[model samples]
Target: MPVGHFPLQDKIVVITGGGSGICFSFAQLALTSGARGILICDLQLTPAAQDLINQTPDEVHFMKCDVTDWNDLEAIPPKVEEAFGKGQVGDVWIAGAGVFEPKWSSFIYDEEKEGGYKAMRINAEHPIKLTRIAMRSAISVNKPCAVLIVSSGAGITGQYAAALYCATKHAVVGFTKSMGQADIDENCKIVCILPGMVSTPLWTGRSDAVASQFSYTDEVCITPEDVAQGMKEMIEEEKYPGGSLMSIAKGKLRNVLESKLAFANDGSEIYKQFESKCYAPIREIWNGERGTKLS
Candidate 1:
């Protein structure tokens, strides 16, 4: 299917954390693709999310939701159903959430003031909880539902200074893999997107450091518009599967599973060695214990 060929006309779509950023851009794309109704929920009511919705021809609704809270997350299904005439939603996108706090920096040595727990709660735990609830709701409806998770390139390959964010993103990637099979029958596809730095409110003062780590040139930095387009392509084409990692930048999309090897020979060989040594216990526990419970 092409970008706008998936019958988005008259479809009901919901986006969490859609108040701003690429997620908000996605709402625009959804409207252009002919979505009939759009429900955008964010941590707090923001004018940006509402502004985007107001431009759409569709009936747009806004809700203040904290993704970390189960009750808040759970309340969305009913509200969306009511707005869309009650039934399965045609599309679902979780794109409005992210974290880039100073306290999350492992480089920040003052643990007492850093409040690392906030990063864990917002970035990792909250998304996981949201995914689980969304999956259950979508599955019960037995419709073709899609999930697009906004991750960073830092998640795929760790950065020296972004340890906490990296850890949270890595967990999201792992969660995508674990839940992939469970949601397959429901036509609930999960896609993890690892985008390079994009121009957004989040980048007001953080671009230089991120650019240096990714070796990104001034022109290489992407925009939220770019990511929103990529997401639309992914959802409509459905070319990528649930466990796939999509790296989108400079108008190119690379499937990590098909185009790359898990390991490569390098001078340090540290990463390969670390993977061999450390992954055994973790993989064992995941496959032996965690896998069973989730399955």
Candidate 2:
């Protein structure tokens, strides 16, 4: 195990979607690892999550948060302060809340659905918004922080049936990798994990619309605990660098190469010329040659 820069011991953590699944499992492990405080934020609480909070009422806390709502996300910093007290900028911020494109908000049924794709808001936009909040909060206090983003195998590998879901995941992968390009040491570290077919409520619950799509053999499915453990290692032991993408699959953890796994950009001269032409006008605008206001 490589030595990690961030340690869970005596540190405060805030997890979105901590009511169940990967986030819930990680919350449990965070307590055992001697974390000082954990705020589990989600739409509602699962029985197991409620039970854990009941057992460790002093250490574990719960807050109802809708990831899609900016107000809900904006309230997190104060909630964290309220639970753990002032100046307690969280050490770990887990954007684990996501949905696997369901019937109500799926691309296939876009015409029937009202408002935009909820899965895109939940899975893609939520992480992006949450990362901005987490990084800023921690940096303002000059504290070390890590933002763990939960993506899916679908983000890297496409699935025809779940195009919306795949796109949401891909969005985060690209966002995390792009964020990694910055000098994170001065601000905060951000990492993303892509879990392949985990046996969680997202896939195992009979009520889940996507459950039927995952009818593969049991051998191929990993437990939420497996992914949680991988996340724990990434946070504590593995010490994955800022902007690293780790894949948890088949009871193993592997590094996802940014170029190949997410966007395999062919370094063709023609492509470079195309990209340059596409960016030249935008760059000129950015340099104030053209007006900056979009509206």
Each prediction's Cα lDDT score? 0.65, 0.80
Q: What local lDDT score does residue 155 receive in model 2, on the 0 to 100 scale?
A: 73
Please provide, for model 2 over 269-295, each residue's C-alpha lDDT reduced to its tens digit, 9 standing for 90 to 100.
876687577557644532342222222
Report how far off residue 228 is in candidate 2 (Å): 0.9
Against the true structure, what is each candidate's TM-score? Answer: 0.74, 0.83
- Residue-wise lDDT of candidate 1 within 91-178, one digit each (tens)? 6656458776454344453453544456666677777777666666654554456676777777778766677778888887777765
Model 2 TM-score? 0.83
- Using TM-score, give the best candidate's number: 2
> Runs in model 1 with CA error above 4 Å?
1-7, 45-48, 55-58, 88-90, 104-116, 205-218, 251-295
Best by lDDT: 2
